[model samples]
Target: METDGGERSISGSSYKRQDEKFKSVRRVFRIMDLVSERGEDLTAKQLAREIGTNLSSCYYLLGLLVDEGYIERVSQGGGYRIGPALPSLHQGKPRSDFDARIEPAVKELAHRTQRHAYAAVLWDGEVVVTQVKSPPRSPPVGVVKGFHGASHALALGKVLLASQGAEFVDGYIDDYGLEAFTPRTIVRPAELHAQLNKVRMVGVGADFEEFARNLCCVAAPIYSASGKVEGAIGLSTTTRRIRDEGQRMTSTVQRAAAEASTLLSDEPDIKDGKNRKSG
Candidate 1:
């Protein structure tokens, strides 16, 4: 009887963990919908008060949503709002048009940097590659269009993740415990925080053979006209290539990203491939 009771207790603990995860996800979605309906910024305390939950719990949920790009800090309003991941111009026809508009720019970036260039966005707590431009002979390793994975492990992912802020990053780490893809992968919370801080200061994110054994990458953020982080653009190459010319490659990608962002703001109507304007 004692053995059976012990086994049941362990099973119950496993079930409780699964239940908590489910509840957390459900709460996050509820908060997202509430933010969308409000269509404005709401402080964590305000949200918590409205939802009848404690402030700490609200912060945890908001942090997770923000990290996943479902919510974003309001620049001028001083609170949280539904992020770009929610329904927006980018969620509809604009995305296809956006991709077409940025395709050539990415190709040019790849050509200039002599690497594989890519553009990615945060989607449902993961990084999704939306565009890619490979060098003539193809760079050694790179993410392709529609590729999705843990955002903490990729250059493109780290850039987007860094834009969300440290509190959100903490929530992300808590929700999706870092999985070491390679020996170099950053698995420690404090180390990843420091790395993200550097990215925040420099406007660049780097993965030095962290995701894969011999692949390296650098990335920069693409900003919306409102100064919000829209997504990221990256270049992937051999670790040796990055080591030999990482500084040059970083400068090239940053310039290209700036140009692309300018075009995104200056050309809102040039959607289809036919109306695409040069950046």
Candidate 2:
């Protein structure tokens, strides 16, 4: 029923709810600004202390940032630090273009989630960060692209391997022999086999201080048009932040990655071609 006075009135609860969202968004932006200025990876504790806030609060904010890509987490000093995004600084054109067809979705994920989102393709046994988005930090850091590394010691590797089917993973384990990077690195073929199985079942894989000392990464595979393993997308963050958010973030990444694969399958061959041009 309209008010007899015909005047506009809003409920207190509605205004408060909107205000809460605004403040929360504002806080998250503030946290990103702090990390951008430091220009180095930061542990959750260190970040909180610098911002004169409690560790728990900082960690919570960091989780939001990671979920949104406002800041990236890396392994550092037995904790997490800042890392680059695929779109940051425009380092890699592939990351920005992401095989052209996938670019729109890739950028959308980065913008919608606000995480240092990117896509990767397995090239010659290496995981290539084909596209990335650093997100809009209070102070942004451009884009991070073309970040590639060994397939054995990173989440990107595990995701791609799992995507390749069990046979490829078995062969890779036999060839690489599960060399340990840190004490945490898996050094046995049998163990890796079991983990790859889990990755296959879950459609995602995780690195917990295995490759790098403190970096914890989560990844999921990208399938080719034929549903073959094409690549992966992941992020390296500190284990601390990962403890609570790993499963959630991995699920998000897995969904996005899987969608990317489905999207690839639906495209015309020339529109979303392979990461590389065949001669």
Cα lDDT of model 2 overall?
0.64
Best by lDDT: 1
Q: TM-score of each candidate?
A: 0.62, 0.55
Model 2 ranges off by over 4 Å:
1-98, 138-144, 174-177, 268-279
Q: What are the per-residue Cα lDDT tens digits for candidate 2 across 52-73?
A: 6688877788886676544566
**Could you give candidate 1's per-residue lDDT for residues 1-279 as a string of tens digits?**
247556534477788999888877777777877776662557777788776678999888888877866676765576765554443244566765566666677889988866788998765455767777777886335654555566888988899888888877877777678999999999999999999999999999989888887788889998656676777888887876777889987898898789778767754543221111122
Instruction: Name the runs in model 1 displaced over 4 angstroms.
Output: 1-90, 267-279
Query: Candidate 2 versus the native: TM-score?
Result: 0.55
Evaluate model 1: give its TM-score.
0.62
